[model samples]
Target chain A: MFVLASASKARQKLLDQIALRHKVIVSDFDETQLQEPDPILKVKLLAKGKADSALKKLIEENHALNTYQALLGCDSLFEFKGEIFEKPINKEQLISRWKRMSGQSGFLHTGHYLISLDNSKSDMESISQNNSCEGVVSTKIEFMNLSNFEINKYASTSEPYNCAGGFAIEGNGGLFIKKIDGCFSNVIGLSLPWLKNNLEKYGLSRLLLDR
Target chain B: MFVLASASKARQKLLDQIALRHKVIVSDFDETQLQEPDPILKVKLLAKGKADSALKKLIEENHALNTYQALLGCDSLFEFKGEIFEKPINKEQLISRWKRMSGQSGFLHTGHYLISLDNSKSDMESISQNNSCEGVVSTKIEFMNLSNFEINKYASTSEPYNCAGGFAIEGNGGLFIKKIDGCFSNVIGLSLPWLKNNLEKYGLSRLLLDR
Candidate 1:
């Protein structure tokens, strides 16, 4: 059994693409509490936090799921010239964010964590032995030279507010992207290839082979 | 005016995503004669061929509407390792292709061309001065580990043969992809972000300014 620690539709859709049977659990952890300069590291840390939170919640719920089952967590950040762009809370902020990103290149970092819960309650066991690995995949995006009118109109779509960096490359914000230098799926909120590669390291092939 | 030089449904759907007003023209170009080993250059050359062929046909048929319009053409290629994968012609080849790429990483390259047509014959004298550009965008995709049963089930859906890589990442093939390393649009047979940027050089935006 696989557990996904996220509420993002994009992430869910990415998993669906792989035909992976997984359950979604929204992480209740507060992301704003983390203080980090590097957006990539921040996302990775957040993903780990979400995984830990989810693992605890699942154990407390008395679910029959094996604690040793694979748990997946993900987080994303938009970085432009070393500045992290968080999710916009309002239309005006989204418009301003788009205006700032117009004609500029930015990086979207999506960090993923695969944690295998240890059913055995042993204090001496190493965490690495319990099987946890993390990685961050970054995608570079170039924004089209957008006019204020275009930016305002796109913001009106309300697609930007909930997305990091005030844009959803898979949604209406796609019109503002000029080019992408790295993984496009990362900007869409997940890097599917990276996820598969990481999952393979966690014995995904063996799991499927046994099944 | 934007004129699309192909009748592909996938291309049309992609254009619709940005709400770009475009007229489709079927280019009766001889694609068989232009086969080459270099996949990137081949796609670009094919796109250019389509654009030129459509431009000529439009000029001969609708002389009144043949002024200062930008012609857009696109082509896609699926490459695994160093080998280029074309659309499968038979069920056996399709099955073989899927078996090879079922759980592997592959590259999808989409080449785009924008050719600005001259209205007057006198202006055609300076055809070199007309704004024209070409670019190739690549996206990397990784497929999940698939069973023989899964491969046969998906191949039965008849979605593999029509796509360049024998898979449609946005459709039933999505269930096979584990992750994507490059642009999702490129894998979907077009790169809207790249198109938007290339169009910007012609003072055009994919998003309507007044929308």
Candidate 2:
């Protein structure tokens, strides 16, 4: 089994898609603790911090970490017009963002940090990036042009407010996207190919087949 | 409301994604009747035939298709190594195909046929391609190299046998795909953006907003 260090249902579904059994352990890391301007770097930092925070919690609880082979943390941010976007702040912001995003293209960057706990370390705090697998997967998305009426109508639905960049590709927003030009799974939340490669490259193929 | 003239659950889910109310009517067209060798043309013909057959059934049953504004038919085929692939014939075929397709790139084409019924004619038979909206959407898919064990294990599951290319992108196959470079929804079954454009451009914008 593996540990997922996030509260996102979308990320959890991604693991289910690949038949990976995982335990959801929400990280206590405050997302607002970082004010990084770079989208890629910000997501990577958040992903690592989330995993680290979860690890700290596991150790504190005296949890038997041996049951789990790996822990994965993920964070997604939409980069549009050189701005970082997570979930829209409010209805007005979501509507306004949709208006501006119409007929435009953006990049969705999802950072994945996977911690393999096979290596025994008496000093848990000694764990560092020296032996971690991580990456920032990005996908380009284009939105179809929308009129004011269309925008208002879609914004009236509750779907747009909860997703990054004010849209959910797998939900109602699927109709609005004109195209995507990269790893499609990254736009949803996790990059499956990236995860599969890391699982194999990090000597964790057991996770791939043991399911 | 619209009439979905196909039996694909994936296509039905695409309509649900956009909150479009649809009445699903299975077409009676015999798929084996099509001997078309060209992948693009074959899908287009199949899509149109499915829609036509459904329309004929509706008229025969004296069904009130007037309640529906449009009818959509969809067909998907995978083009790999200049060969058309629908579903793998059997486990051996699937394994062999996977072995040959490992680490290879191919195209997934989904043909969309939309028939607008608002501007109807006295004779339904008079309707021609000139008045209909259709297109074949294609997406490039790259597969990751798989060992023999991986192929055999994936084939053991019922997932790969039913998909067009011996893989389900939205299922366990999601891990096997390295990247895709086109309309993501098309790979699933329907092209949402293409449908959105046809709805708006062909003066069927009501389908988009009234949904």
Candidate 3:
């Protein structure tokens, strides 16, 4: 059995795509407290924090955390040039970001962390990053040169307020994406190919096979 | 106003992405009757036929066809090597196609035909393909090396029976697509960027901007 430690609908839909059986337990980790400036490291830390917090909650609930083969957590952020973007806090910020992102290629980095609690790990290394397997999937997204009218139309929608980069690739914003040079699923928030490859290392590929 | 001459949910969703208000009137054109072996020509004929049929129906119903700016029709086919794949006929065919497509790159060709009924064109040339601007948008899609288990699981579902190439990039099959090298929306059944560019030529981009 596998566990997903985030409550994102995109991630859940991804799991459904692969027919993976999993349960969602929202982690209460405060992502706003993360202060890392490097976008990649920041995403990795947030994913790890969410996974660790979820595992702790399971343990506290006497849920036999070791019974589950793996717990998966993921975090994603958008980076254009050198700046990182999460969800915009207001309509003004959202519009400002869209103006800058129009007609440009950006990188979407999604950090995935898998914590295996199979009762076979060394006691000292169980909770450390070294003990867990992690991977970061990146996809290049090229946006169309959108006019101000188009940009304002997209920014006026609520989809930009809850998604990284002030846009949702799976929603109305998909119209503005001209090209994608990497895993399409990564742009949607999770990288299925990366997740599949990582699961093989943990001998959990059978979960997908049997399903 | 624009008229969409197909009932495909994917195409409708794409139209909705840009907030374009349109009416869907399913065309009665028979695609299988096409004898053209060239995939590109076959798709173009199919799109044109659909648009022509829908326009005819609208005229029959006295829908004020001249008042509409454009009528749009689209048809897509997956070309792998030299063969054109529309929908897989059955589970066995779907599984066979997936086996051959595993880890391979193919092209998705979407033929878009816009029949402009704006008040500016001569009555005789308005409905002809020569007067109606058309385009073909092609996107290269790379599929993951799917396992037999994965292929069988996906083939068991009805998703493979209704879409070109027996898989949908916006659905479960997205898990197996590793990369895309052109417009992503083209793979989804329509190319928004291409549509936008073409609409500009017809002075119909105003439809989107004014919305």
| Best model number under DockQ | 2
lDDT of 1 by residue, A66-145 (tens): 53467888899899889998888888777777788888888898888887653544431233336788889887887877
Candidate number of the best TM-score: 2
Clash pairs, model 3 backbone? none
RMSD of each: 5.6, 1.9, 2.9
Q: Write the residue-wise lDDT of candidate 3 on B99-144 in tens digits.
A: 9999899999999888777664555334655547788898898998
Clashes of 1: 5
Which runs of model 3 end up more than 4 angstroms from their true locations?
A: A62-69, A117-131, A206-211, B118-125, B128-131, B206-211
TM-score of each: 0.72, 0.95, 0.89
Error of 3 at A149 (Å): 1.6
Instruction: Quote the TM-score that chain A achieves in each candidate.
Output: 0.89, 0.94, 0.92
lDDT (C-alpha) at residue A89 in model 3: 89
* Real interface contacts reproduced by model 3, as a fraction: 0.69
Mark the 10 consecutive residues where model 2 chain A has the least summed lDDT: A122-131
Per-residue lDDT value at B196 in model 2: 87
Ranking by DockQ: 2, 3, 1
